[model samples]
Target: MSHIVSIQTEIRDPVAIRSACDRLRLPEPVFGEVKLFSSSATGWAVQLPEWRYPVVCVVNAAKLAFDNFGGRWGDPKQLDRFQQIYAVQKATMEARKRGHSVIEQPLEDGSIKLTVNVGGAA
Candidate 1:
């Protein structure tokens, strides 16, 4: 069995989001941060910081999705998500190094999630 998680916040500044994404690119894939933007019924947006390529990221995102919408645990799905995030994070880093921007669109169901900055010299 698996667990579900939900992420909720209210901060949507395009500049801030872009800056955060840029800063996140400085780290390695295992410790890159990803921001999730969510909106309430009234169109209010929230920014959520998450780890982009970690097992915890996938598990947490699924938890949030499941919490919002009732669902059963699917480990395979979660693992697939982890892989996707990792690949994306790696690609994002490479793109950023080449002076490109990373834009991750939000999901309609409000399950948007990402990774946190890590993999720094620790």
Candidate 2:
């Protein structure tokens, strides 16, 4: 009795999606055109373990939409994983792009300490 669920999100970058998948140790994401509500959009497909269908990620003008998905083979935890991995990847990319250094430390509490800076060299 599981049905498709469309989970809206703040994710828009295809590169970030790819990075997220990499963090999960899953297969590379598939990217191309997708059908949106009233039109078609192009983005990537997010695939988690045991999911028969992938969530369609469509980006338009820097906005991302996660189309309705997750019928029977979907785990709600996958969305959490995507957010976590995407954040790390996006943070690292932005920091480096700003000519800064990034350091990620995994805490004993299972959280990550992400530090970014120019190390006062600026």
Candidate 3:
């Protein structure tokens, strides 16, 4: 049996998403850019940035898993994880589309900092 693993990324801009995809050497059309906001004790906002092509990050990952693991990723749990990661990637991309720079470092805090700046600086 083959095992497949995909690293998570935080990017909220279409441009940034494209750059990341290139950096990761992943295929195109990772996802769409859209702002998602949820209100709670700690209000949180999420965004999924648009891609240059007609590709969804989630879908690409599924394909990659199948290619790497020989269909083992068909398992429901694996699919769920793929979807969750994809959602996060999309949200990150959206944030970048809104002119917010997302910087994620290895730390306990799951929060990512968005630096708003004029012009593109990714």
Q: Which stretches in model 2 have alpha-carbon errors above 4 Å?
A: 1-9, 33-42, 61-72, 108-110, 119-122
Where model 1 places Cα greater than 4 Å from the true spot, the runs are 1-74, 109-122
Tell me the deviation in Å of residue 31 in model 3.
14
List model 3 lDDT by residue over 8-103, tens digit each. 543234554445444444454334342222211211112223221122333333322112133332344433433444444665566677875654
**Better structure of 1 and 2 per TM-score:** 2
Error at 54, model 2, angstroms:
0.3
TM-score of each: 0.29, 0.68, 0.29
lDDT of each: 0.34, 0.67, 0.38
Candidate that scores best on TM-score: 2
Candidate ranking under TM-score, highest first, comes to 2, 1, 3
Give one digit per residue, the lDDT tens place, for model 1 in 21-71: 344442222223433323212211212233222222222222221111212
lDDT at 73 for candidate 1?
A: 29
How close to the true structure is residue 36 of candidate 1, measured as C-alpha lDDT?
Answer: 33
**Residue pairs in steric clash, candidate 2?**
5-69
- How do the residues 4-122 of candidate 2 rate in per-residue lDDT, one tens digit apiece? 32333477778888888888888888887755445565677676776655666664555544534544456767766677677778777877888878778888875566666664233
Better of 1 and 2 by lDDT: 2
The 10 consecutive residues of candidate 3 with the worst lDDT sum are: 39-48
